[model samples]
Target: MPPSSSTTSARSSRRPRRRRPQGKPQQQPKRSLFDEVGVTAVDPAPFADLGLPARLVRALADNGMVEAFPIQAATIPDALTGRDVLGRGQTGSGKTLAFGLPLLAMQQGSARPLHPRSLVLVPTRELATQVTDSLKPLAKALGLYVREVVGGTSFNRQVDTLRRGVDVLVATPGRLADHVRQGTCVLSEVERTALDEADQMADMGFLPQVRELLDLVPADGQRLLFSATLDGDVDKLVDRYMTDPVVHSLAPPAASVDSMEHHQFLVSATDKQDVLARIAAREGRTIMFVRTKHHADRMAKKLRAAGVPAGALHGGKAQNARTRILDEFRSGATTTLVATNVAARGIHVDDVSLVVHVEPPADPKDYLHRAGRTARAGATGTVVTLVTDDQREAFRTMAAQAGVKAKTTAVRPEDAELARVTGAREPSGVSLVAPKQRETPRGRGANPRSAKRPDEPTRRRRPSERGHDDGRRGQASSGRGARRGNRGGARQA
Candidate 1:
């Protein structure tokens, strides 16, 4: 029916009113980023009762993981449900499997070449290698292939492996960024992501690259972030990307301090070098930490000169050399290793009885990680910091911030406390002389340096030259004789 002009004008002026459907409810906003969310405690259970696949349970049983750690039992179920997670635990607390098993259980089919289904990001190459190695046996139980992508390895080999399918990839941020930039691997296909030691990555200034990689993954992809502490930049990461992630905080976030003992030794300036050498000369494996790379090299050289088998490890070394040195240290071929900050968090050598700080670390985190190198896996260890008069206050502040009570002792090179703490014996008087380097064979091998003939007299100097030498020697002798006479006269007077 045609309406009047006034009614039609009124109808055109009115806005269309929307109505809520009867069954649907009103939508609510997501929780605020800073709101305090309650964390759920893990239910007590074994791996079999935790809803893991029989095959994975068998693999866990094979690896002696019959019972779930608190972190695993708490995070696994939620992760399996495809939720983003923020997990916190101590250094040795079973984080690898807490994220790893769930990520593996979700991958049901073959992955496309250059497109992995899962990614694990670590801050260093050593950690990347270890993660890949640790997860490979577990991956094998599920018919998956795990690969490592790191900076020190051949890029071509990594590319080839990516061109062939990789089910799981454990990589450092820098190397993975290279693969993405080269178009060798597409990260958009990554579904499950885990960032191990996220705090260290932030401390290392890799958060930008981490953010870039996170952006490359699909928006719906699940993520798990694990760190010892979350503050500053790490907190920013959680706020921006994560959507209501379940936060799990475990006590004793850093390495356990119960198994560790700390000491600060005060040293005189003149005796510092001798004291360092004495401590480094200990019998069992000892890791020495210095502040700078140059210092690390110099300390290693000095230790070697003092008859201690020491190797220098720093970022300046090539990757192969670093690996070789670490292998030698682990094999007991090198008893002491002098390293900069690179080895503080990366090294995982077992049975390291002592750690010596040639200089105290700049911050508490550095201090804690340096001490954490020892006393691992429930083993006992001692950490000694060589403090001079000037550094005492700074070290005290650092220890306080790290929540440690370090014993301060005034010590000398010959002190018994050094032996009591480090098990260091008196250095053998003989320096560890380097074996003579082999010379490249010369043409026909004629006139070797060892061909000196004892019968042939050395060349004699001319009269003028001999006279000059005699005058110099006479001057030195006269000066010494005059000094001795003066001393005797002074004593008689």
Candidate 2:
């Protein structure tokens, strides 16, 4: 006979509630920040079908962008529907348009002075400028104004632009922080915020400033983060900020473009420079990455002396000088660019057929970014790293970590294989005169003291005298103490 109901209840109660198997309470596996639904491969979609404004579609067509890239097609739909999106694509995957189209489409009305309706935060000034340029035409089609705020440019000009009003503001984390601190800009009205190259921003120690800026936006504002990789601090950002974002990944974490080729050319230290100069004299645009600014400048001089139209780009050059050099490169006036890591991320030029690493980068990410300079937009390109006996092991390890299995070769300055692989050719023996620099003066009075005399010929400085030249000199002014402080804060921010 079954126990009476009351008796059963009393017995169940008397049995000490089954203890929850104590000791740390069986920690549930952590949930991922993204609830990732399967994103199947999507074919290119026409701009009109993506729910974009008719004017925007026309503008895209005018720009010769009739169909969307894979990344653009996948993200634009969800982004237009007002959902947070996490996009991962290799460099040169047309990510700019993916987030940009939706950002412009969501604007309802005019923005107030100093308060933009949309914001795009990038890692560097070059990227900020590029993003602004990319969106300006589209923004105009939608009757929106896009402004760029970054360091190495006029702070007062940025403030004035904000005062007039802006619809979209593209900026680096530091400069944007400086603007917010100076009361020249406000973020409370930002309805959409996109972080391009989010992983690089995190790597550059801008995560704190990025977080601070993001916090100022309303908690409910839509966030769209596009990154080449989604590990480490990037994961932290997604967990803290994104709300069940739809994740779309078009490539693996490390960038591996199908049209890109990687080669490791082993050479002796004595022959490395010769091999590099030969590669620099290649027929098409080539970007050679060096380890230091001094090295970049010196290498450019050496190449110029060899009759290679090479320009140096690094943090050591003034902003105007950097811009001028990059412009020359883009216009085909300069055939080669010898740059430090500064140009690895934002220097996007068409027909860059070759990328050479004069020295191995600090790590795998740098290697990938440096290589990404070429093989852009589905174009075929080659990446060759000049490795000596000492660097082979390190480079091999980095390659393994970066998911690359490059073809190894033993080559000398005169090897036919080198010519076949890299288009190595002898440079003309005519030394080209370094162009005169007329940089935009950073402050008042034109810095007469720092100007070179017209009669004086340019001379290369000794490495010992360089002493870590990072392009900071001649930036401060006698009358602009506040400006100086702001600039300093940006550099350190």
Query: Tens-digit lDDT track for model 1 on 1-493?
Result: 8999999999999998978767867686444332244344565469887778899999989988798888888888888888999887655557888888888889879789999999998887667777887789988999999998776556677888998999989888877876787798899789889998888888877888888989998878898988766767788788877777977765443334688888999998898999988888888889999888799888888888888988888765555566777888999988998987777774688889898888888878888878878887558899899999999999888888888788889989888987787776777766775333332222122121111211111234599977886797699789989999999999999
Q: Stretches of candidate 2 above 4 Å error?
A: 1-40, 444-493
- CA RMSD per model (angstroms): 20.6, 12.1
Model 2 accuracy (lDDT, Cα):
0.83
Q: Pairs clashing in candidate 1?
A: none
Q: For model 2, which pairs clash?
A: none
Q: After superposition, how far is residue 243 of candidate 2 from its true place, in Å?
A: 0.9
What do the candidate models score in CA lDDT, each in turn?
0.79, 0.83
What CA RMSD would candidate 1 show? 20.6
lDDT by residue (409-475, candidate 2, tens digit) is 9999889999998899998869987899886645332222222211111234577545433233433
Question: Of the candidates shown, which would achieve the greatest lDDT relative to the real structure?
Answer: 2
Pick by TM-score: which candidate is best?
A: 2
The C-alpha TM-scores of every prediction are: 0.77, 0.84
